[model samples]
Target: MTTANNANNNLSPWQPGQSGNPSGRPKGTRDLIGYVLETTDGGKELIDALLFIVRGVTPNVVVQKGTRPRKGQQVRPADQLKAIEMLLDRGFGRSPQQLDIAHNVSSRPLEHLSDEMLKLLVESARQLKEGIGGGYW
Candidate 1:
């Protein structure tokens, strides 16, 4: 059985919003993962390999078909998923996710809503976000 590890919170005396060392690592600073990757021997090679796989340059990686399964073909779940995604993305195209009200309004005629109505909608949305509204979702 593994023992539970306790954090030494009392080690740093600094309170909230106060730092012991102010001139620490600046904002937008990346961690050692990137640095390690850059310094390591097979890092570039690994990246190139990953890119090659993603780009579908390597012959025997995943599904060969861009569309969904037909006839009596041996189906790999991962490949099948990719095929479905590829088919939809390339053919019908992926639709943008809307907040509650889905579908493109541009295609359908929209009535000009009043300022009060707009405000109410915004307030309702805010309430939904804050979990104040009766969340059906």
Candidate 2:
């Protein structure tokens, strides 16, 4: 039977501590998102667009070089809802999810458990994580 070290060695072509690509991603090439959100005004523009949608306001757009800004159609309800969700998600972290676990076993220190008990505890924890059983022994 192949050990973990042997399996890893078989999978990887390069030696340990050696990078697969010596010349990695080019230097001075910033991520597109970083460039848009940090370096440019795109982030502010995005926030403004979201706010406009949430407020049901029509965004203004310039038609020509000298022409006055024209009012676009009112933001759709679906789009407004999506924009509100996005703004809320960005402004505050996502809401917490509540799990309905029904475990009967109270928490105990690992050092107090025997080897067999430890194995059972580990299996019980796994079952709880997978939402398999209602309670653990």
Candidate 3:
């Protein structure tokens, strides 16, 4: 007869889409956790993880998506660097030594962040700061 070890070898680790609930969260648990998990609050943990990883590779830089500036609304590279420094200071509660770190790990700068992208990043950072013991939010 097949044993549990045999079953274990055959089955892959849990995946959300494999089931109705991809997070291995039980069915209907999504109904309850969905609001929280799908929300800024719920997703803050993941967002923070991503940001932390980016911060780890470089001290004073943040990686973000690239986008074109809106008409009549321009952001210069210097200002973008300043904004990144400000965001890092606010989120980490520490002073940044430089406005922007050279692409030590990535080729892009934060200025390339789009309005929507920046909005989400700021919101995520804000939510995480507030949710955690960090008081910068």
**Colliding residue pairs in candidate 3:** 16-22, 16-23, 17-22
- TM-score for all models, in order of appearance: 0.23, 0.45, 0.20
* Best of the candidates, lDDT: 2
Backbone collision tally, model 1: 0
lDDT of 1 by residue, 1-137 (tens): 23333355336577999977798886546656667567655365544434443454442333355653344444455654565565567558885544576766467443576778778868987887886774543
TM-score computed on alpha carbons, candidate 2? 0.45
Clashes of each: 0, 0, 3
Q: TM-score for model 3? A: 0.20
Report the lDDT tens digits of candidate 3 across residue range 1-137.
47988988987775764665555745787587777587547767545544543443222222345643344443455655655666677678884333343555235577887889889867877885886523344
Error of 2 at 60 (Å): 3.4
Model 1 Cα displacement at 86 (Å)?
A: 14
Candidate 2 lDDT over residue span 29-137, tens digit each? 6676687788438588778877877899855533377774346665789989998999988889675555675875557667887999989978988886776754433
Give the range where candidate 2 is weakest over 10 consecutive residues by summed lDDT. Answer: 61-70
Report how far off residue 107 is in candidate 2 (Å): 17
What's the true lDDT of residue 73 in model 1? 45
Question: Which ten-residue region of model 3 has the weakest summed lDDT?
Answer: 54-63
How far residue 132's Cα lies from its native spot in candidate 3, in Å, is 5.9
